[model samples]
Target: MNFFSASYNSNQDLLDHLKSRGFLESETVYQAMKLIPRGDFLPVELLDSAYQDSPLRCSRYGFNASAPHIYGKCLSELEIEQGNSVLDIGTGTGHFAALASYLCGSLGRVHGLDIKSEIVNFARSNTETFKSKSGLNINVEYFVRNCFLADPDDNVYDRIYVGAACPKDYVHQLLKALSPNGIMIVPAGEELLKYVKVDGKLKVQYLLGVRYSELELPHQHEIQISYIQHEREKSLKVLIPKNGIDQSFRLLINDQKFSDVQLYILGNKTPINVHSFIFYCRIPSFFKEFIEPQQINLSESPLVSILLPDFVTEKNLMMVLEYVYCAKLIDPTIFESNNSSPDQVNLELDNLHETLLYFKIDSLVEYFDNVSTILQNPQPFNLFQDCQSKHLQMLVQSFNKIPENIGTDYTFHFKGGDIDIISSETVPHLLEISDFYDDQFLKSHCESILAKSVEIDNVVCLYILSSRLNAKQLFRICKEFIIENYPKVSKTANFQDLDKELLCQLLQDSCSYFQLLFDRNDSKIKSVELNETHSQNL
Candidate 1:
């Protein structure tokens, strides 16, 4: 047999092996796996074991292509359809993309991104050969970019699958990229692997019991040397929040003379209500006392307390404490407590609000408001305020900034008192605030005014407002707007196609809309339709 056929047969044999090992579930996926030759994507030396169930190291670094079974499971989880668009993050060797292209058929598209340009180039050549040999035309695009950073454009994709484990903050970026009702599968957590989905709402399913490595930004040479120095010092225990873990660092000193010193902690740029510390400390022995036994309640601030030796100077202790607090404020972690109470949660929130105000994190105030809304009780708010929480003051200041011209078109109108009144520019500011806070009531009013205004440059704002509204409500509003003004807008606007799909997905209770769109008669909307056959496979 030729190398290609030999590789294909060996992969087919491996699929049978995995099935026997209970790694595979569906025959359709198994058949798809057998059709795509894995050897075409591997190096010559590794070609002998191309069909093996285990992962193979591909580069000088620890970069490795996923095992056949893992790739099969991911594809099976995706349950790709004939014409769906798929985005594969960290596309190693293009093996997964090859299978995805086959499953998606002639009408589908697949885009793969990898950081290494060399690997991407290699994948391109392999894909070209595979297409020629099989005579199966498939569309695949590869880009070299850091996956950790957010993409500038909002290309709402149908399916997004990440090969690397990402931090909690990166999850929001992935969710934003997904089309409403679209599914995303990611491996999350620092020490545990959890398969999370952002399908309409966030959901998680813990798949494997193994922990994957953290996805870190590329470090510079100078930063690497600095980190080496930092690591060499006696290690100091630093507690970091779930989101801040990657950015946090610990300081260690070798001086034994001033070991047991009292220190005060402070914060900056840190989230409000975090329990950080100001305290006296001794080296290794004192670290034990500062470490909390369990995760601090949402209400409690992180604190560090240390018992100092009698001989330690208060002046030196204060200097060390100030430095530690500065570091803590920059990267604070949630304190842990066994018996957290409602009062504690409020205190933490209050502290967090004050901290934000101190640092002037204007955008973070909105985050605080969202948190406050979730808590939803006067006592907690009051308790938080008692702790000198500045969040309420910030909220009040923010509320006062709401412009009077908000929700009004900038046009001259005749008043009943025989006076002509002109609208103001300040109105759009309210719409900005409404969007920030996700205020549905205010957004509807602002959208109505902006939709009618002749000077409004873009209709995107109105579309965003429509997105927040439910299908029936949004449709009612849109229908009313269209009937009263701009009746022919939808027919001429190509971008409205996405808006229509968004509305349909939001409004319809039954799957009839999808069913109709999938019908061959609907050519215009076919590209956006969800294939029922693919759903069945999932």
Candidate 2:
């Protein structure tokens, strides 16, 4: 509501100096800088370097009057126009406030805040003197506020300039303080961040970075809500700016020269050369028993060779390993299938399923669950035989087929990893030498030993399996079966072939069955003494 004008031609040299440095682009901003002489805002001793486009120390505690170009950039980003209301958050020495006041002209007003009372008073005094001496029609209100706070309902400022670095979450407060269509300029991390309020949400852009002090804000529980949102966005690479740095483990898996890996899978004569980095963590069950990732010294020792059993083929093993490393099935190249053939697709899917199941790798089974039903549907589409994993199906039906796996490849299921990752031929030798491979599954080559109709064969094999594989459920079931049916099973020919130790265990576990088998002969004889006599007879 006042009118006055004065000559600002005195700092035309400083104003031109700014323009020569490729700054002060907007005509209104350039005119605003020209009108507000820099000398009035700086200390008398610091006036010599005030025209330089760099931040100058305004306080003993490491605060600055932002450089001319930085202030110009903030002004340009603010999009200041006549009659626009502005809030300058850390108005040190009042230079930016004075420039903002000039741009807002006779119709606008500027309010400024600083945390320290001394700085706020100095800036207030400086702006008042500049207003009187220059005869400009501007009144900028300066106040000391330790924290950024404004009523959301009463927010009227069209533009806000933060004179400090703000945390990523402080955008919420900045948004709350701005009028509709307002812009806020603040420093976040190593970059200058600009946010514009639109549709009640703030959209952000990273502008150029500059050194600035941390902004002061009050504690409110709602701050976490904004911070969590910022963290979520930043994790998805939305808010953080990228510096070019790349890392990959492909060379460790594929390259031959590094040389810590030797995989001797069954059915393949050549050992697989792999880096420990590839499989050590991926196949934790196998690696926990065999590989040490950190203590690997490949050059000092002969190449570490591992042998897998006959049931696990090298082709199936390699495909699953590649999938673990790449997170997708490798392109179909293993079996030389026609690219368009439906049989080839089914074979690939079956191979994937069997490989995962054979290793008892339950974690990877979920990946094959969504495999296309066309490859799974055998009755209607396939002209040949069914292509599902028969090996996997056999294991699943093992409970129903009671002892039918004798002469079949019996996969020893070990938990917490007590078995060696080697061929069954090599493994039997390990068991003979030491207790290291204690978990063993042995099915005799004699088909009569595992015949389904023979209850004695099933009971003896199930007992042996339960003991060797540490299968508690099977052991309990076998105990109950032997207790109830031992009288009938005692006459089977397979009972004569059962190991002496199993015979003694059966004698020890069910004493009443012994009496029943003996037809009440010497019923009260000492059981331990009888066991010794029975062992000797066997």
The segments of candidate 2 whose C-alpha lies over 4 angstroms from its true place after superposition are 1-14, 60-62, 150-153, 199-201, 221-538
Clashes of each: 18, 0
Looking at model 2, residue 362 earns an lDDT score of 57
What would the per-residue lDDT of candidate 1 be over residues 1-538, giving only the tens digit for each residue? 4322223247667777677756667676787777776788887878877876666788643467767767766777677778877778788788788777777878887888788888788778888888888776756888876664444333566677777777766677556666655666676763223333454466665555433444555433333333433442212111112422112212122222212222323332221212121111112122324432321322353232333333333333333333333222111123223355767655654565554443333443454556544345322111010111122122224344543333222111100111112223543554454444333444444444544552222333344444554322333444334433433544545335546665454345225433543443454334335455567679
Off by over 4 Å in 1: 1-9, 60-62, 189-199, 211-538
Which number leads on lDDT? 2
TM-score for candidate 2, please give it: 0.38
lDDT of 2 by residue, 1-538 (tens): 1101122234676557556655667788888787786778887767777666567786653478777778877898888988988889889888888888888877998888887888888888889888899998667888776434433224468888988888877666666677878888888766888888887777889878667877876654334334443443332221111211001222234345554557777766777676443343345454445555333545556356777665456667666655544343433333455564778667666766766765445545653464443235322211111122232222233223323232122222121122323343433222221121122231111111222222555676656655564444345456556666878667667666877887887778678545443542333345557778999999
